[model samples]
Target: MEKLRVSDACIGCGLCVAQNEKYFEFNDEGFSKVKQEDVEENDKEELLNIVESCPAQAITIEEEK
Candidate 1:
């Protein structure tokens, strides 16, 4: 399993959302939020693409049991 975490450093740039709306979303304040705290059995490389695209460096994906 993998978990996506958004940090307070997020400036709400929305890049993560733009990259992958299925895994990311825009809140009322327009900040990008992770749609799911965790995902199972998927392409981690694609997820990493979205996380790494975050200019704010707010998104992170960590492997979990």
Candidate 2:
């Protein structure tokens, strides 16, 4: 399975959320946060787009062991 993470580098630009609200959302501090849920295999492509769109390079997708 794949996991999504938002790093401390996030600048709260809200671009990720704007791209896909189903996977990303804003936290109380206004930074982007990955929704806690299993990332389906089909969602990888879209997730990658979101990851690439992050100007701060804060989003990451990793394979689980």
Candidate 3:
């Protein structure tokens, strides 16, 4: 399985939140945070695209055994 994460490198640009509200959202500090950690198998491709498109390069996907 794959898990989603948002790093401290996030610049609070809101790009990830804007891209997918289901997976990302703004925290109290206004930085982007992972709304959900578990990534669905069917949503992998789309989520990967969103991860790559993040202007702050803060999003990451970790493969779990």
Best by lDDT: 3
TM-score of each: 0.80, 0.90, 0.92
Weakest ten-residue segment in model 1 by summed lDDT: 36-45
lDDT of each: 0.78, 0.87, 0.91
RMSD (CA, Å), candidate 3 to true, equals 1.0
Q: Backbone collision count in every prediction? A: 0, 0, 0
Query: What lDDT does model 3 reach?
Result: 0.91
TM-score (C-alpha) between model 3 and the true structure:
0.92
**How high is the lDDT of residue 43 in model 2?**
86
- In the range 20-45, model 2's lDDT, one tens digit per residue, is 88888899999988885467888889
State how far residue 22 of model 1 sits from its true place (Å). 0.9
Decoy 1 TM-score against native = 0.80
Worst 10 residues of 3 by lDDT: 56-65
Using TM-score, rank the candidates from best to worst.
3, 2, 1
Candidate 1, 10-51: lDDT as tens digits: 998777787777788888888877787776557578877776
Model 3: residues >4 Å from true position, as ranges?
Answer: none
